[model samples]
Target: MKLKLRVIFFLIFCLPGLAILGYSAKLAAAAHGLTSTGLTANGTIVDHERQTRRRVGQWYCPIVEFFHQGASYRFTDNDDCKQSRHDAPTGSRVEVVFDPAQPSRARVDSFRGLYGTSLLSAAIGLPWLLLGIALVVRVR
Candidate 1:
């Protein structure tokens, strides 16, 4: 196949899959960071299988509500807290960082947590993407 065709095919198939993975990761990470308190009322626990360990893993995620720039926003861990550590007890108050311009943008701890989640999704998606590319190359 021509390079243009390969690129087009890759974008048509791989991009959607990767985009879904990436956006979901971003949302999960955003929600995970929003929770300022430990797992409890607004928080949730997700049981998901780990890609690396191939084992069922549990993650404690929190729901945080905060006010920034004269507006209030809320979010939850959803699925991004897979490997995050629980540092405080339930109801323990914690500082949450959020974008003042965008109150919905928040994090329970470090920004790295979200980045890690996104990276994890990319890592998981890369092999299939590469496999498709390989098949295209081989057929070509």
Candidate 2:
């Protein structure tokens, strides 16, 4: 294959894949940083805000409450489950991970809550990356 064509194809396929992979890695690193280095406390699943999306149908945003330094902080989790998931029902106990400087900005210390964004991004990026590699190798 022509060098220009190869370079163009590599840019088209590899660039976005690498960008996404880098972003996913950054997200995962942040999540891990908060989990391993931030403060931790026991929290409760207070409620869930019902939400609807076009084509994605229904979902629920979990509301959680926790205490840190004699202060109670409540916030909706950033876990994006695009379905009626009752995995963590109201009154359930969960681990809350938070930064000491900003307790209000906390998250549930579950697998999905901690790494969902990264996992989702990797799901999109890894395959695209592999396809790009395969295409570039076979583009003779």
Candidate 3:
């Protein structure tokens, strides 16, 4: 009975961790591809917004505006993957990398901006995965 329970718990924890790892891998690959084949543009930090979370403190998300193909595009760096919320200040200039076919799909041209989410996800998921594996091995 204990072994069965351990197995069940292992599956419950391991499956989500594996899924997160897969998703993070996909995100990292897409970011790498975009960085390699995207066009560069100058972007301006227009504003900053504070995103509040239940348990976590407020996060500062930057609103950046840039031009592509003579049209203006605005992007918000609001994803929770960044280690720091205060990455950019208002009125600062940043380099943006955008897809030529779809300018709306863009990211700040930096290592953290491009792949921070995936790296963060991997960092979190890997430990869960290892714990799951250890639980399963102990069950045997």
Best by TM-score: 2
Provide backbone clash counts, one per model: 4, 0, 0
**Model 1: colliding residue pairs:** 31-76, 33-107, 33-108, 35-64
Local error of candidate 2 at 77, Å? Answer: 1.2
lDDT per residue for candidate 2 within 1-140, as digits (tens), equals 46777787688888889999999999999999898879889998888878887888778888899998788899988674536557667898989899999998799888888999899999999888887777777778
Which residue pairs in model 3 clash with each other?
A: none
Question: Candidate 1: deviation at residue 59, Å?
Answer: 4.8
Determine the C-alpha RMSD for candidate 1 after optimal superposition of all C-alphas: 8.4
Question: Which of the predicted structures, 1 or 2, would earn the higher TM-score when compared with the native?
Answer: 2
TM-scores of the candidates in the order shown: 0.47, 0.88, 0.85
Q: For residues 1-140, could you state the per-residue lDDT of candidate 3 as single tens digits?
A: 87887879678878878998999999999999999999999999887777777788777788789998789999887652333545566788989999999888988888888888999999988988888888877775
User: How accurate locally is residue 19 in candidate 2, as Cα lDDT from 0 to 100?
Assistant: 92
Candidate 3 wrong stretches, greater than 4 Å: 80-87
Please give the lDDT score for candidate 1.
0.54
Sort order, TM-score high to low: 2, 3, 1
